[model samples]
Target: MTETWPARFIAAERYRRHRYAANHPLAIPRVSLTLDLIHSYAALSAEEYLVSRRASEDELAWFHTAEYIEAMQAAERAGKVSRASRQRHNIGNLENPYFHDFFTTPATATGGSIQAAEQVLAGYLAFSPAGGMHHALPDQARGFCFFNDPVLAIMRLRREGWRVLYLDIDAHHGDGVELAFRDDEQVLTFSLHMDTAYAYPFIGGGWRDWGVLGNALNVPLPKATRDGEYRWIFGQLWPRVLRAFQPDAVVLQAGTDILLPDPLGKFAISTGFFLELVEEVLHSAPRHPHGVPRLAVLGGGGYHPLTLARCWTGVWGLLSGRRLDEALPEAGRRVLQAVGWDEDEDEDYYPVLFERRVEAAGDGPPREAIRRLAGDLLEQHPLWRGMT
Candidate 1:
C-alpha cells in the first residue's frame, strides 16, 4: 500500500446507511459513493481512511442552540415531529424532512468536519466528503441542510485562534457560514454562487452585503455561467484576496453542483474545471498569511450522484497526492454505474469517470454579470482595494 501522502480521508459505512427523506435532493448517497470509487480505484491505503464519529451535543452547542438540537434529537427518536416542533425548528417539512438519523447523520458529518479541522491544525490535510451543510441556520433548517457543519468547524477553528477563510463554490450562496462570521474579522467568507435573486437562500452573496471591515465578499454569478468566465473572474481577484487575508486555515466548501446537467445548478462548469479550481486552492495553502500550511476540505452540494462521486473522488486524489487516470478502470466504472439516478433512464454508455474537456460558453449576461461582480469586489472590498 502506498503511504507517502500527508492527508487522511474521513468516512464510514454509516453515511450510506442513513439517507435523506425520499424524493429530496439529498436522498442519494454522496460520501459513500465517493469512498467506493476511490477504493475501487486503489487511490488510498487503509491507513489513510478514518472512520467518522458522531458529534456530541456539546460539540454541536458551539453553533446550534441547545433547544434546537434537543428538538431535532427528539424528532429523530420518535421518528416524527410535532406540528409545533416542525414549525419552530423547521424540521419535518419537505425541505428539512423527518427521518430517523436526521440528527445523527448530520452529527456524524459534523464530527468528520471537526476532526478534519483538527487534522489541518496539526499540519496535515483532511477531506470530509460528508461535511459542508452550509445553509443550515443556528436555530432552523434551511435549504435541505439540518446542521451547518462548515460553521461548526469554522467556529471551532476560531476558538483555537486560527484565522479562517471560508470559500464556497456551491451553486447556492453560503448564507449560514457567512452569517456566522459576518461581523468577525478573523474569518473571511468568500462565495461564488449563482445569484440569489432567483436561487435558494435568496438573501446573500451580493456585493452590497460585505461584512464588517470587508470581511465577507460575495460574487454572485449569473445562470448558465461557463468555466472560462469563472476562471477569468477567480484568477483576477481571488489570488490577491487570499494573499491579503493570509488566513491561518482555509475551509473550502467544494460543492460540484456547478457541473452541467445538475438538476439544481444553473452553471455550465465541467467536472475537470472544478477539479482544477480545487487544485489552485491546494497549491496556495503553503503561502497562507499565518504561515500555517493547513487546509480543511468539505463537500457541500451535488444533486447528481454520478457527478458527485466523480468530483469528490477526484478531490480525494488531489489531497492524497495520487495521480488520477483520465479514464476510470473497470472497477471504478462499475461503482458509479451502480448508482441509480434519473440520468440512467436513457440508453447506456458513460465510459469515463471524469468529465470530458469542453470550451466555455460565449459572451452573454453571465459573463457580463461576473465581470461586474468581480470589478465591484476588486474595487470595493478592503482586501482588494489595496491591491488596486
Candidate 2:
C-alpha cells in the first residue's frame, strides 16, 4: 500500500501445489505462507504482487548445463531419476531426492529471481521469496537445491554491468553461490554461516579458504551464536567490505534458518536481527558510485514454516517501509494459526510476530574465538586490501 518504497513481491501460487514430497525438510509450505500472510496484513497490493514466470531452457542455460537440464527434465517427467542420472547428478540422494515437478518448480523460482534482478536493475527493490536455492550445482543437485537460483540471478545482474556485493546470512554456507563467482572480481561474496562441524555442505567457508580471486570472505560462526555476536561481527566487517567493493548492486541471500526454533540450524538469532541486517544492506546501497544502487533480495534456507512466514513477511514489510509491531493483527494471527506442523510441541507460543529475547549461550565458543575469526580473515591481507 505504501507507494514511497517502490518494491514488488515476486511469487506464484504454484509453489503451494508443487512442493517437495512428504517427509522432506522442504515439504512444508514457505513462499505460499509468506504470500498469504503478506496479503492478510495488507502489506502487498494486487499491483505489487507479480505472478512468477517459469525460466525457459535458454534462460536456465545461462547457469546450468544443457545435459543436466535435460536430465532433470527427464527425471521430472518420469517421476524418478535413472540410475545413471542419480549417480552422476546426485539427484536421487537423500539430500536431493527425486520429486514430482522438480525441474519446473525450481525453474519458476529461478524465473522469479531473474525478474527480480531486472526490477532491481531498473531501480526497484524486488524480493523473490522462492529464490535462493544456493546449494545446487551447475551439473549436480546438492543440499536439496535443484537449481542455483541465486547464482543465476547474480550472473544475470553481472551481465547487465553491475558490480555485485553478495551477502549470505544463512545458517548453512552458500557453497554453490560462493563457488560460482569465486574467481570473478565483478562479484564480491561475503558469507556469515555456522561452523562446518555442525552444518550441511560441511566443506569450505572457513577463514582461510578465500576464493580463487580473494574476492570472498567466509566468516564461520560457532554454534549457538546469538544476536549480539552476529551483530558485532557483521557490523565490524560489512561496512568495510561495502566501502571497499562499492558495488553497483546488492543481492542478499536472506535465509532465516538461523532463528532459534529452526530444527535444521544451530544459531540463536531473532527475526529482528535478520531484518536489521537487511535494512543495513538496503541503506548502504544508496552510497554506491552508481546512483541509486539496486538490490535483489532472495529467500534461502529456513526450515520451520512459522519462522519462514514471520521472518520473510517481516522482510517484505521492511522492504515496503513498514516496521514490526509487538502484537500481530487478527488476520495475521489466523494465518499463523492455520500453519500445520509435524510436531505439536509449542502451538500456544508459535504465533508471536517478534522473536523472543534470548541470552547468548555461554557454553559455545567464547567471544575471543569470534575475534580471532575476524582477525584471521583480516590477515588475508590482499583480500582485505583489494576492498580497501
Candidate 3:
C-alpha cells in the first residue's frame, strides 16, 4: 500500500456505447463516474494513463472464436443484425442486445485487463474498472459482457508461467473465468458469489465445480448476505485456497455488486466491510505465495451510482493507504452528476450511498462466525501449508 506501488487505473476518452436502454441498471453512470472520482482524488498521474481501444481482429483471435468476433463486429457496424449472427452468437438476446460498435467497449475492457496483467508483471499495481466482465464466453456473449476480460487476463498470465490465485468478491459468480480455467492447474480461481438458486448467471459458482487439478473454489452465499455471513465463509475458504495454490501472485475481482442497493444483488454488505476485505487480502494472501504483488480488477453487479463510486474509492484509498474522507468531494460529485446527467435519469445522485455507519464487530467479520467456519479449515491444515 505504498505510493511507490503505482496505483494504475484504466479508462478511455472514446465514447463507449454506454447503455442498452433507459432504466437498465447496467446503463447507469458507472465506469466514468469511477474515473471522475479517482481523478478528483489525485491519486493517479494524468500522464501515466492507460486506455483501451477497439481490439483488432488479431487480438480478439487470441482468445475469442474468430467467426464470433466477425459476426459481432459486422452486426455492430451495420447497427443491425442478420439472422445468422443472432442465432449463432446470441447477440440479439435480451441480456446483451446488440449495439453500435459493440466490440469497442468490451474490447477496451478486455485489452485494459490484459494490460493490467502485463503491468502487474512489470511490478505495478494496475487496475481496470472496465475489466471483470465475468460472463462472456469464447463463442458468445453472456450476461451484459460481450468480452471476458478477467478470463483473458488470467489466460495471458498463465501463459507467462505465473501461478495465479484469482479471487472474486462480486455477488455474481465469475462463471466465464471458472469455465476458462476449469481444468487448468496453473491458475486457481476462488469466487464468493451469491448462490445460483436466487441470482443472475444461475449456472455455476458452486463448490462442486472444483477444477481438474483441484484448482477451483466456489463458495455461494444465499440472498441478503450480511458482512458477517460473507466474511465468515471467505475467511475459511481463502486460507485453504492460498495454502493449496501456493501462488506466484493474486488477482482480485473486487466487484461492488455485493452491495445491497446494487441492482443485480441482494447482499447487504457495507463499504467499510468491502474495504476491510481488501485490506486483509492485500496483507494476508501474498504471504503464502512469498509476498508477490497482487493486481485487482473491478468486477460486476453495481448499479447505484453513488454506492459504486464510494465502494471503489475505498479500494483506491486502501491501496493509497490514505484515510477515507468522511464526505464525498465536490469534484467527485460533479463527475458523477455528469455521467448521470447525460443519462438524464437520476439527477440527485451522490457518491456515498449507505447511511454512513460502521459495523460493531470492527473491521472484520463477526467473531462467532469466523471462529466457527475457520476453525474447521484451520484444523484440517497448518498455516505453513499456505506458504509453501
Query: Which candidate would rank higher by TM-score, 1 or 3?
Result: 1
Residue-by-residue lDDT tens digits, candidate 1, 1-388: 1432488898879877877767888888788888888888898888888898888899898889998999988887888888998889888988888876767888999999998888887767889988989999889998878889999888888889988998999988998998888778899988888988888888764777887677887888888888788888889867887788888778999988888757799998877788889988887764334443578999999998887787888888888889787577788767866774545355222333333322235333335667777777777777766653
Relative to the true structure, how large is the alpha-carbon lDDT of every model? 0.81, 0.81, 0.69
Please, what are the lDDT tens digits per residue for candidate 3 over residues 65-91? 989888877887888777888788878
lDDT digits (tens) for residues 1-388 of candidate 2: 3323578899998988866668898888899988887777778877788899998898889878998999999988888889999988989777888777878888999999998998887777899989988888889988888888899889888898888888899898888888889778898888889888667778774777677787778888898888888888887888888787788788899988998778899998877777778888877774323444378899999898877788898898878777656456677767766875636365544433333322224233348889888777766635567443
RMSD in Å for all candidates:
3.1, 2.9, 4.3
Give per-candidate clash totals.
Answer: 1, 0, 2
Better of 1 and 3 by lDDT: 1
Regions of model 1 farther than 4 Å from truth: 1-5, 287-292, 342-366, 385-388
RMSD of 3: 4.3
Q: What is the lDDT of residue 260 in candidate 1?
A: 75
Query: Looking at candidate 2, what is the lDDT of residue 221?
Result: 89
For every model shown, what is its TM-score relative to the native structure? 0.92, 0.92, 0.85
List runs of model 2 lying over 4 Å from the truth. 1-3, 287-293, 342-366, 386-388
